[model samples]
Target: MLNWSAKRPVIAAVAAILALSACGSGDDSGATGKKDSDGVITVKLGVVGPKTGPASLYYKYMDQNFETFSDDFEEKYKVRFEIIGEDDQASPEETARAVSRLINEEAVHAILGPPLSGNALQVADVIQKSQIPWLLAGPNADEAINYDIQPNWAFQTNFTNQQIMEILGTRLFADNNKVGIVYSADGFGQSNLDHLKSWAKENGKKLTAEESLQPGSSDANAIIKRFKSAGVDSVFMGITQGADTATVTRAIEQAGYEPKTIMTTGTILTNYKTIAEPSQWENIQIVDPRNFLEGGDKEILDAVQEATGEAPAIPTNNISTYAMLDIYAQAVAEVGDANDREAVRKAMEDIETVHIGSLTIEKPFTTTDHKLYDDDPANWLTYGFDEKFNLKLLGTAEECLEKGC
Candidate 1:
């Protein structure tokens, strides 16, 4: 369970502060899709994410790319783009308010993200009622669209939990069926656990042990002990926070149990080299959308560095956000009118088999299925660190299944 004692007050304080700033000295006319007098179309885009809370680092990488995308889009299409960002502080309630302000106050042509699954769930109704084209760039939860929300207008850039677990299960079941899981006691973790359960059932594997912990929790010795007692051959981790990943890895080492460990993205942090012992870091795999060794999208990286004066050290989220924006831009260019949200939605749905950045999608969006990549192993890959502590691509999703890593 989440420790809400300290975070609740912080969320409330940030919400109050953002509400004042959002409502201060702005045109309340909710006008959208306006063309400038100079024949340059103005597209207002809304970005909602936690810029101040525990998950701030992930959103901060996303936030930095907005200006870069805005400038590039304007230069390419001769259209003026305006970005309206709202800090949700990782609160679901605040996400609702932020999305509301974007739709009813700023009147954005398209919305970017809420980042967290809980926040996305809170604003699903508002997004459906408003009929705004929303691109969920974070929180790989497949149920976000199935919660009585309209999937026609909602789209996701990240791989869903099912897709992630399928690849993981295929790879793990090939080598060892005895598995243990340690997940965060939150929505993201729950989604992962649910998907892993489904995958295990379908693949005829049984979990030997399962455990959960709150994010930022340092007490992982008990969970590690449980896994050790279970005598599992492989351990699957669903924790998303960097600190939690470090804590758990340390505990595993302290328990003197070294099993083939598989972790989800966001677990591999730069600080892990310092937090975890060198021996414990070996034989660990991270499943992620981007292969860091591939050096994603040099053009986008250059533009971001030029705009921000510093490029992100880890450019996975940066590239992913850019790809999402690129898709939106393609739809906008084809629709020719930034104000027609319905038309843009149609254009997005009509897109089939296009390569944006280093990733490729086939029939990326549809009315019923908002998920871009479902059961497509090529969309994800496994990565592990080499002896020099540099990221090395283990294999593609297909390779990992065909030949166990």
Candidate 2:
């Protein structure tokens, strides 16, 4: 086991060596990266995401990890990945174009990202038709993946909105709490609203108010006052950007009204803490599949920070990307041929478990289910932040509800 207390130095040293080894130039000649005579199978992977657009901040550590950890993964799995990145500009239209190009022009063996749920949906059909393994490390909307589709090519490494909402709804709607939602007026927020409404309806909970906030909005005082007027004791935020989340929090603080439960998605763990006041962060709770708290997965977090000299802005996505690569690499190794796309896809489906750094995921993917994390409370961690902006573990969703943290 890669325990933080025992093997910190060893992991750091290994990551450093790997970083040094991957300093060489890469071949971007659009080759298939077929198995060479040296017994090394090269996997050409198409990476689609917003590399230079507004949502580019979400993938800061993705390309960095790919560059820094190439040697480490290749050494173990005997698979060298030739990464081809496509900038989708965080747009559905751009995502369609990028996916098409990767399928036709690049001829990549596998595809990863187009991180937004809306973007993923835009190209889901075409990518599935291409028969390439689609590695979803970011988007969380349940609709982004369709397990009913035969030979399901999409594999989600991130927890879906349904999974997080189940945990959030249980806590937020408990004790006859009057809940209100403030979601961004975008696809991400729309998905959040859809899931929230579904959970509420199934559980017979009533929402006090539902407000939509546009991205880059500077003020949310009106929304805050509306919630207050509607007697909303709990607030569920589905905003996409951390800055927008901060704006809402700032408004709540300025209004001098504190909700009992201020629950939200992993956006709180993003740049929200940096921009929001410490007081505004009070009563906030977030449910995430990967525990980025101090006592959880510190080894990988430390290793990535050590190698890249920067902490991951979106730790969940960063960690998911790391695990996704490990799972994909293992699939390729099991098939023993990266060129055989169908075989690799099947291998990915049958992978029972994988341990990357300090995280061990059992049943990462199976034939019937393609999601890496489910709605199990045991697989999710609930956390609150301290005034100092450090993650304070409340516990698992079950434990947190039973005993206050």
Candidate 3:
């Protein structure tokens, strides 16, 4: 083994090289497509996310969908796709390096990934400067982009914090009920809390209690006890992981505090069912752009199961990936050249309507609006869980707000 003194020079030299390379000029074409004599265009795409980490579950089934759906996409659009994946481990530092390598070395036409809001924030400016099409399938912070900037290169397939809070706020604040929140002390949770506060201010309401939980915390009894003391009638969770949400759920059951409503985002649908008892999930509800219960996305879900011989571990994210790829393929075809990053970006913004599987999006994109789903309560769906933790459709957000589901 090398001595510490001997290793110092080598480590410093490698760091210098990486720093210089990151600042160096790369291919100006920006992952241009190449056409072969057979009249086929090949586009290279870079995928960034945690392949192995505490958060790896968020990336599950993404790669499989890429493989299972490629042939069909190629047949329809006459364009072939080539994917280059980089494992960021869901760390901001690793995410920065992975994004740099993808943009500077991999030369990808577009990039998707770094599901967490914090990781996404780490590379936002560099990606925007690179002028690459950024397909945001995760990370819902409204601050992800400076909205004042025109001709934005990034587009969001995930709902923003503001959009989700708009729907949840109406239900949680109905009948002037006292509300309490328990959020993870992380970027995702912080953003959700900030939006919730804004929603309350705009609507002239007040939250009775607020608490923060660290990731992987094993207990939330104190948080639950505080909510009880505050006489909170509704409980809203802005936690990042399903397991953490389970901790809160278990605490609520143990303390025998029955809030009028228990609500959270789709993150609860990740692993809460497996970690918490069926009874703990009794009155829990969540709002999402897509419905997972009763197979609202049955057509694509069934196809993926048949192709892979198993169901997606997280059906909502898998279907989001499917929709994102479809939109990317459509843009490439519309531009007639994936090599022209600017053209492809513009094409993506102009897509008015897109239908895939059982999901149909109207005006999915526009020059000024990049979010796949807007803040219209009508566009959001509400869901509850059954005794077996299966998704049960509640109603549209508008209907659910006016009348209990």
Candidate 4:
């Protein structure tokens, strides 16, 4: 059984997603793409992230991971991946512009994301008209659904922010009451607030307080005082990586408020610990997707870890980025032709199971849906490290993955 409910978090907006159902083959203006010659299957994937912004360091790490991706695909598929990565500076406007350049100018077969939907929200029209399959992974605010552009070839790997709230609701069922939320007051933070409120009401849970911080602001003493007054023993935060997570944690400590636990989104999990103080990370829990490369399961990842000198992946955004590369490669192998959209689309539609040695997902993509998980990874776990740097799984991590929930 599918087990979906009407109250489930939205994927696309009700209206726009409804319009997508009416997206018959209408009048279309498309890109006249150049063919890859010389018997090499030359393909391009448009990758946009904060390559030069606050998250630039981890984006550089993502670039390095792409290198391993391109190299591995070349060895396996006998193709060359011309990665046209654009630095959006983590700005939504700039990310939209970058996607335009990548698809219209660079002529990539697909477009990836800004690792945050607030930044990547405006480019769906271009991708849809181009008839290029967009394998997106990023922020999950349902902005993509309401972005007024639904590409027939679009699919998202990351879950919506509401789904993260669902994960936290399940966690609140055990050992805790009252979650204090610290959000960034932007679109991303606001949607998360919506999710948190809805979850609290549906589950008979109490919200201690909700704190909305301005984007890029560091002060949280006032908000911390509110949490203290409410006696919030646990925290639920939604913001991208940077001063947001660190400042929130610092303010909690400064205000003399100690939470029993904390739950954060993919935003913080992407680049949090690397930039935050090591002490701030103690006992903090963030949700994560499975990035199998970090484990000792495959030689490809081992080589990558050796070459990059980074820990491959502790299972987060890097893992999804790597998997997106595989989906593209496998699609091309299945049905990509030099000048045909139908073939490439069919290959992507036909993706069943992708078992790369040990890294795998259950049932994969089909014609009707594009998401990877039965429930999103945000539905799976609240994973983070303890004061001793040992990982702690607060929710359904081990149960869903190893024990087959």
Which candidate's TM-score is highest? 2
Error of 3 at 237 (Å): 1.0
Tell me the lDDT of model 3 at 97. Answer: 95
User: lDDT per residue, candidate 2, 248-352, as tens digits?
Assistant: 999999999888889888876667876888888877888886767554355567766766677776777877787788888888888877778888888888887
Assess every candidate by TM-score.
0.85, 0.90, 0.89, 0.78
Give per-residue CA lDDT, model 4, range 257-346, as digits (tens): 767776676565444565466577775765554432244224444544554566544234455555666666666765545245557766
Candidate 3 per-residue C-alpha lDDT over 1-405 given as tens digits, one digit per residue, 9 for 90 to 100: 111121222323322232223322224422247555665566777777787877877666565565356555556665665666777888889999999988887777788777778789889888988999887877888878766667788887778899999889989989889999899898889998999999999999988989999989999999999999999999999998899999999999999999999999888867777789998998999888776654435565666676556666556667777677778888888788887888888888887655466457767776777888777888678999889987888898888998888
lDDT of each: 0.68, 0.77, 0.77, 0.60
Tell me how far the alpha carbon of residue 347 in candidate 2 is from the true structure, in angstroms, after superposition: 0.5
The list of candidate 3 runs beyond 4 A from truth reads 1-32, 293-296
Off by over 4 Å in 2: 1-33, 294-296
Query: What tens digits encode model 1's per-residue C-alpha lDDT throughout 225-295?
Result: 98888887788888766667778878888888877655555445523555566666677787766655544
Q: lDDT of model 3 at residue 262?
A: 94
Instruction: Determine the C-alpha RMSD for candidate 1 after optimal superposition of all C-alphas.
Output: 7.6
**Stretches of model 1 off by over 4 angstroms after superposition:** 1-32, 147-151, 266-274, 295-314, 352-355, 358-362
